[model samples]
Target: MAGIKQVRNRKLLPDLRKEGHLSKEIVLSTTEKHGVPAGSRLFSHHTLASVRKLSFYHPFSIPEDSLDIILAATYDHSYEHFADKEDLYLQPETRGCETWRRLRNTVGKPPKPKIPLGHPMKRGGITERKSPFSVKLMNSGVHSSQTNPGYSRQPAGGAIFFY
Candidate 1:
């Protein structure tokens, strides 16, 4: 929270780094992926206000139970609002070009890798962090004769099936 004071004073870089109070970033990223659920306490006014102030990028307004439509509207509104504030309307040449460049750079390409976290690796070069390539098993949808549409049930032999 001390860093919030630093940010408010403009002492810290306005650009967001990976570390910090990541709740806003987590919510935004997750909303983009899984969508926001209704009555999410995470979007309560007090929490959202703090997120608005601290977040580097403008957080898009997420609609309850509707992701695509809300995302589109939020995108359009953000573009128009920022365009007006940056005076892209009055000054077409300089202002518009600058705005375009900044926006392009921000959204254009993938960022290069930064330093990895945690201590140096041991002899085998393995760390405690989870690897992306790890193998895993997932539940497959299979139906049993006794089950209904998309319904799963434990069979007599402890096998699960979908109907």
Candidate 2:
């Protein structure tokens, strides 16, 4: 984001000025007030003029009526907790999507568990069958069982096993 800002400040500003979209005095004054850093080769004296022009025409400098119109048209106020009843009522319905409905319905309920409790292992029982893919992989020698000859070792007499 900073890099983009810097490019706008340096490269884009100068280009706009060169195209006569900005004035010479604006360039000189802006550069003088907020001098380009020594390492900023792209943002020269000319870029400063464009920046000054841009600052004068900033969105915040827009009239209150225009700003209000823009805000009313683009800003989403539906999710604001402190929004007035009128504002909430005015918002377009966004509950058609499953995710939006789920979000709206989540109030006061404990969040669902990360791991499903319905799986056989979680229910304190082992699945008797392996997945077909796992069986195929094992038969293809791509996945070997720990009890196979390549991995198996006799337990040492001194080793203590724990359940």
How many clashing residue pairs are found in candidate 1? 3
* C-alpha local distance difference test of each model: 0.37, 0.38
TM-score of decoy 2 = 0.19
Tens-place lDDT per residue, model 2, 34-143, is 45564443444433333535644332232267445445342365657675545533322242222211112122233444555565344456848777765535346745
Q: For candidate 1, lDDT tens digit of each residue in 1-163?
A: 1111111222112223222334543443123213455445334222323533765544443335544433333234445654443232232223333221121112223354454765543577555788644523264335324444586766576766655
Q: Pick the candidate with the highest lDDT.
A: 2
- At residue 101, candidate 1 shows an lDDT of 15
Clashing pairs in 1: 142-161, 142-162, 143-162
Backbone clash numbers for all candidates listed: 3, 2
Per-model TM values vs. the true structure: 0.16, 0.19
How far in Å is the alpha carbon of 92 misplaced in model 2?
20
